[model samples]
Target: MKKSTKMMFFTMMIIGTMITMSSNSWMSMWMGLEVNMMSFIPLIYKMKNNKSAESSMIYFLTQSMSSMLMLFSISMNSMMENKMMILLTISLMIKMGAAPFQMWFTEMMNKMSWMNCLILMTWQKMAPMFICQMSQEKFLMSSALSTMVGAIGGLNQTSTRKIMAFSSINHMGWMMMCTTFNNNLWIMYLLIYSTLMMPLAWMFNEKMIMHSSQMMTNMKSMTEKMNITCMMMSMGGMPPMLGFLPKWMAINSMMESNMYMIMIMMIMMSIITLFYYMRITMSTMMIYEVQKKWMMINQNKNMYTSIMLTMNLLLMTMMMFF
Candidate 1:
């Protein structure tokens, strides 16, 4: 892709975000979403690989369907003298790839490059989540169920991208829970998540591939191993890292709200999540010189530096709170 084209695409995504923020009507929100989708299609194609193309197709179709459903729900609400929170909530849940509709997320992650996966994981999430929060009273059940499903589903993913996909879904549950609390918490969670995740994606993107097995023997130095450990721990929501902060805040907030049932459910699921995270962390940290020879490609230094630096800083930041 040309420099001009990249600039143009980003310009449109920003415009779409602006439009969605300014508008109360669903029509304007739909337009903004289309703009965002259109902008990203180019980034997906920039890789020029078949997998990228395939992932792009799936993402576009799924997003289009969700946008259409949102429009239809809004129209229906207009006619019914009031909004049907259930329909709107379901649409938002589908868009966010929450429970009962999370297949698309896992599938897309399986097919995309690491960098593309990162973009999908982070940037693509805000709009749908915002829309869902807007109608909190209408979709609380779906949100609650999505939280449970996301936590459980992430427990067994083998692929790195699939793991992150489920992690995003899991975190979505936490983010949704925050909606019931206060706007300050919601914004804080978003900020902290974005701060931590951008580097995680960058770290993985340095590798280009999405399988933990592929990374088993790639790093030769002790420094690289430690950096990877930090990232994996951050994702696991372990103490002394930024990731742990959100989960802790969320649990405390839930308990404070007297939502004991959901709180206990989240705690159990979180323990399950530790297993998946540990699998990756173990691979990255302990597989330095395993017996079997594994085929690997040239390491990308630029990608590695960015991920390492950003993640270490995030880890350090989290440790300060301890």
Candidate 2:
């Protein structure tokens, strides 16, 4: 694609998200989602390979079906408000790829470029999830199901992208739970989730890492390995890391709301997710028998990694003080 074309599509995505965020009416929100889908489809299609084309087609079909359902529900809500609300909720759930609706999400992650995966996992979630928050619907069953599916689905995956996709679903569950009690907490969770995800995505793109098996073979130095391990652990929301803060806050809020059963289920599922993360971390640290390859580390990349690690540590300490 041409530079100008890419720029245009990127701008459209941003504008579309802004429209969704600012829109008070369901009609405008739905329109914004359509704009986002249209802009993003081109970005997903690649001339070099048919995989991107296939992924884009799947994405388009899914979004179109969801949009149709949403439109129908909106039109019919006057006749049966409660039933229409449930239909509308399901439509948004499908759009966001919350569990049971998540098969397309994992497939797309496997086929997409790292940049596209990042957008799918993070930016693409904002509109639908925000809509879910605004709807104030009871999504307890969906939230729990998504959490369990994300945790269990990722346990056997070797693909790094698929693992992250499941992780995103798990976080979506947490975000959904947050929406039940407070919108402000949902915003905070999203912010922290995106912040922690950006560095990991950047690392994956920089290294061209696609699988968990490659970590032990590809990483050069102990420092690099350690940084990646810590980052992954942090992303898993391990205690004493910056990632833990949001989950901690979320659990606290849930407890205050007398949501004990759901809170317990979420914590258990999170532990399962963290177990896989630990497996990845241990693989990086323990299996270091590959022929040593002296790959020159880029200074800027090193600086960025250092800054991120330092900030995480600093924040962890600051939280401890409070």
Candidate 3:
């Protein structure tokens, strides 16, 4: 793709996301989504191959399905008044890939570039998240259930992208649970989660190639290895890190609200999720994967510096939390 075309494509995506996020009505939301979809198609094709095409198809289909559901729910709400609540809840849940609707997330993560994965995981979420906030009361119970599913689903993934995808879903659950509390706390959680997660994903993308089993092979220096390892722990919500701050608050909030069952479930789920993150951490830091004699690892100074900077910021942010 030409540089001019790439520039135009990203410009349009940002514009579309902004418009959709600012939409007052459901129709405008759909329009924004359509623009985002169209702009992203070219970027997806930039890879130029069968697998990329297949991945684009899957993403397009799922995104279209979710958009249709959102439109249907909006129509349903306009007709039935009270029924709008349930439909809106269902639509946004579908959009966010919460629970039963989450298969597309993992599938897409596995197929796309790490950069694409980061965008899909973070930016694409804003619209549904905003919509979910609007239908807070109607969606509370469904939100809790989806959160539980997200927490558990992330526990077993081996692919790094899938792990981040599930982690996003898990955080979505925790954020949804915050809807039961005050707006101030909810916004704070969102900011903190975004602060930590975006850098984490960016760090991962800078260091690891998609479909590669482990990233340590790509790390050329001890500093790079240490940075990546610390990042894995930060994403796992380890204490003294910004990631842990939100989880701690969620647990405290759940307990205060007397939601013992959900809190306990979350605790167990966290433990399960932590195991996989630790596995990746070990691979990247403690136990190096020995490559076959014939295999070669590429080391680019620019990529190494970029990832090292991201990892440093993540660690530095966590340090600030303490």
**TM-score, per-candidate, Cα-based:** 0.86, 0.95, 0.82
- The runs of at least 3 residues in candidate 1 whose Cα sits more than 4 Å from the true structure, single-residue gaps closed, are 81-83, 289-322
lDDT measured at residue 295 in model 3 versus the true structure, 0 to 100: 62
For model 3, where is the 10-residue window of minimal lDDT?
287-296
Q: Give lDDT for model 3.
A: 0.70
Q: Count of backbone clashes for each model?
A: 0, 0, 0
The TM-score leader among the candidates is 2
Cα lDDT tens digits, model 1, 1-322, are 8989988987887777677766797788878878888888888888788988888898889888887777888788757734555667767777778777889888988887776777677777777766665664534465567666766776666777888888777777777788777455666677777766776676667645467776665565445666677766766677766677878888888888788987788767666666677877776676565443464333654556676777667667656754
Candidate lDDT scores, in order, read: 0.72, 0.87, 0.70
Decreasing lDDT order of the candidates: 2, 1, 3
Itemize residue pairs with steric clashes in candidate 1: none
* lDDT computed for candidate 1: 0.72
lDDT of 2 by residue, 181-207 (tens): 846888888887887888788878877
- In model 3, where do residues sit more than 4 Å from their true spots? 182-187, 211-213, 288-322
Which candidate wins on lDDT? 2
